[model samples]
Target: MPVPDPEVRVTAVDPHVSLRTQEGARATPPRLRDVVMAYVGLTKPRIIELLLLTTVPVMFLAQRGVPPLGLVVATVVGGTLSAGSANALNCVYDADIDERMRRTRRRALPRHLVSQRAALVFGLMLGVVSTVMLGLLVNWLSAGLALAANVFYVVGYTMILKRRTTQNIVWGGAAGCFPALIGWTAVTGELAWAPVVLFLVVFFWTPPHFWALAIRYREDYAAAEVPMLPVVAGARTVARQITGYSYVMVATSLLLWPVAGTGWFYPTVAVVLGAAFLVESHLLLRRAAVSDDVVDLKPMRLFHWSNMYLSLLFVGVALDPLLTR
Candidate 1:
């Protein structure tokens, strides 16, 4: 049975008492540390880490060696705030369905650790601060791009696309790609084909990365009425799409080698990493071919590997300039 929204009260034997009223009466005020952690949780730090991973490496590549220490620090700080703002706003909008989904039920809003209004205000504040910081410390172009990405993730992905379509993560995921552009522009103060190539690489990588997790949480999304690809489509179909996008992502990663005119080290690393990514994606397809069950599918294997693949691949990106020099 589906869980009822928390706002709805269940009647008790006395009729005058309710489950929520009793629970509220029993609840104690949250401790200071717990309150601080709850606000931090709204930012989704792990996701921000991944965004920054793509960021700093591109800055290295753009510089063709070490980027200035001050610029790197400023860009990272501004990027963190910008990404945090988008995520916090996303939590505010998704709080209703988040309560119904098992995977997201423990988030701050669903757990009632923070009020919706407080989260909304906090998100807006972060965005404004990040934009101003980036404009002043980094560059106005980087700030503008970061602000655009923040708006797109919150308004475009979270509000418009997520609940409405199966292709939600495909287009919505573009917001995550901005860090590449931001990283490059922070170094050069302008856009170029090299960063755009990295942008496309992340673009194609998002679906496969996110869908693998969605496959694991298919039931939760169904319960929440979100139309993630795994929820509406068959396991085999979703796996096939994952495989297809994996090929394109690998191809795009290679484009950076030529577009940036990097040394042989980058392409060699890209090839090895791309091969492993393909193998894992195909393994998921093979598993889906046999059984539709989540247990049998073991989609998390690909999910976990995808994280390493992107991280190591970008590590190669950062290493190439130094090694070649």
Candidate 2:
């Protein structure tokens, strides 16, 4: 049987009342801690961390050194809330497919720990508060970018593109690039060639990064009828597309050196990181080319490595400004 709904959603439940069953029998109330954890999970904190990783380094570089502590704090808080809003809204929208997929079945909406109504309210509140905070405390430019990202993620990606095409993540991923732009604008109060290149880097990087994971969980997407690339294409085709995007991603990273006029530190790190990323992509491609079955793909190897590559590349980006001084 499905878990019975509480009189109030998990996030708003009264402390003293136990959750009741559908049959009207008394059930033990979930601890406040569990309810809190469920709410946090709705925001997809791990993804927010990755998004913010790209965010701060760009701010550091834009400042040409350290940014103001107050501005940084305000931007980080606003960015966190904005990202949380986008992610929470995604959960609310995708709750149907999420329940069908093994990976996302435990999310708050699917488990009924958070009602759709509560989730929608939480996301909207965060988005409004984040935009207002950034506009007043940081800058209107950053606030605008944050609001735009929320709209793209909620309306453009989650609502329209996601279920309609195998290329869902490709264009939808554009929304994720806003943080780099927002970070740059927060400091300079305008756009520039440097942040534009960073935006492109993320845009190209997203497909390979996400597609590798999609390859690993192809069946989950298939079962959910989400039509992710790996679900619709053969292993070789998916791997080839991943390799193509990986090439563009690395080439784009190299362009940042010449265009941004960064020091040897960033170029050197990019070369080493790009080489490792390419090597993994090639290995996955070779496996897919030789194997008749998707089982031989080992796409997760590249998926895990992609995470490390982005982390390392951005770490280099963060250090370049300070070291070049």
Predicted structure with the largest lDDT when compared to the true one: 1
Residue lDDT tens for model 2, 1-325: 0000001111333322322322143276657887788888877877887888888999988987998989989998999999888888888888887766666665777667778999999989999999999999999999999999889888888889889999888988888888889999999999999988988888888888888888777776787788888888888898899999999999999998988889889999999999999999999989998883557887778878887998888888889989986
Give stretches of model 2 more than 4 Å off: 1-26, 292-295
Off by over 4 Å in 1: 1-26
lDDT of 2 at 175: 88
Error of 2 at 21 (Å): 13
Model 2 clash pairs are none
> TM-scores, in order shown?
0.93, 0.91
> On residues 62-88, what C-alpha lDDT tens digit does candidate 1 reach at each position?
999999999999999999999889888
Candidate 2 shows a clash count of 0
Which lDDT values do the candidates have, in the order given? 0.87, 0.82
